[model samples]
Target: MPRAVRPDRSINAEDYQHAPRPVAAMPKDYAPGEEIAPHSHRRAQLLYAVSGVMRITAEEMPAGQAAARPKGIWIVPPQRAVWIPSGCEHEVRMVGPVQMRTLYVEPDAAPGLPAQCRVIEVSGLLRELILALMDEPLDYAPDSRGAAVARLLLQELVAVEALPLHLPQPRDVRLQAVCRQIEARIGEELPLEDIARDAGMSSRTLARLFRRETGIGFQQWRQQARLAEALARLAAGQPVGIVATDLGYAGTAAFTAMFRRSLGTTPSRYFETRAPSPAARGRSR
Candidate 1:
């Protein structure tokens, strides 16, 4: 995969607060598999995808200490944005042809927001606000309509709830080992005992560590990892059967049941509904 191309010096988060403009937006189109190398911003960011999925991995910290931050993965679909605190190192990969619209907020302007990286809902008002703000120059007059829009956008960001969809990274060497195995062969069948043994820990010991580190049992953590992986494969147009079999389900039927249980939608409808369907796009073409 190639990296994204951007002109001008990269800006940091704090600069947004002192600039003539307190908010900024940069719109771009990305091909599938395109990535941005690990980097950090001086300004906080709201990464909103107008039409595709973005796989974001930021440093995550343990449980309630997400505010402390270590690393986590956010599978951002349309109508959603990932809020990243200023100065957090992260990377992004486009899962499909992504029409991305990102908002960079001044931390001083939007205080009390999540300190860690996580997904936030993009409401209709917020969506239009982003479009409107994108048109203003970085130094727009503070008293102008653009300024009002910027302030309101900050307010809306504060009220939204964080989605419980991000995959938190485990820090312990033993816990990390099990997570790597689950992702390496997401669909392959492997007993927990076997996975624990590979990590040089008994099954019970590993399970305890998972709960302590990630705040979830081993099974739940693995399922979310599989879901995150499934989103990537499905967004890239993998077949339902292939994904199901790859994830370790018995068949398409069983795989879908777990998918629906985990994500609340069937695999066939998940990515398609996030954007226009092929048939719908065909008619437009």
Candidate 2:
């Protein structure tokens, strides 16, 4: 099967070009089906999906000039939101109709929050408090109760440990070609011969490298990539048939069966279980 294709808005280099100072909020309401672009800000951010589900991918940039980095993280859930520290580059993809409420805080405030990347649970009360904070206006008095509530909300954000579902795309010349081909033709079934040719190696050599670098065989690694894509596409509310076709699956049932095998639940139920808190629902407007 091929990888899945999602309907994210095209992103440009300039989006991740400029960096802002660590501080507070950005007044932007992401639409149900939109891409937040690949960008990094001065302040660390807590990307909470107030309503619906969202897919987030984050990684560290190379030491110098770069296209895209190696290691990657894929996040999809309402109860769970990714912690992006200041200066770390990241991208956002909305799955379904997501009401994303991002709390961008200064570096000084970082001490109170998670020091590393993690998924924080947005409990009911905490969710309400965050939505209320968003409505209090950016210029709310420093000594106001609203500010206190906001501080409390930040403190209440408990980090949830999870398996590191990140894949490290190596910097080897052979691996680069294979990675690019896979990304470019996400909707096409990748043939072993083509991948081996692109990598400038025999099929046997390529398979060995995949296992060594990625800890999985070429086929398994591709499936993981496809699953990551599927999670992103399905979270965006794409039809199963459309997603299946995009991933080069034989049919929707085949794609669904694969999804079920990888994940414990079906796509619809998986998304349904990720519904945002009531406060998230209130902030949907």
User: Which one wins on lDDT?
Assistant: 1
Q: 1-285 in candidate 2: lDDT tens per residue?
A: 321111221123233223232223332346666887776766667776655566666664422335655555565564556677666667777766665666666657535565555555556666666656555545556677667766776667533344333445665777867877886787788789878976678988988887876666777767777877776676656898999999989998898898888765687766665443333443223
Tens digits of per-residue lDDT for model 1, 78-135: 6578888777789999887776766776667667767778887677677778766765
C-alpha local distance difference test of each model:
0.73, 0.62
lDDT of 1: 0.73
In lDDT terms, how accurate is model 2?
0.62
Clashes of 1: 13
Residue-level lDDT for 125 in candidate 1: 78
Q: In model 2, where is the ten-residue run with the lowest total lDDT?
A: 2-11
The TM-score measured for candidate 2 stands at 0.63
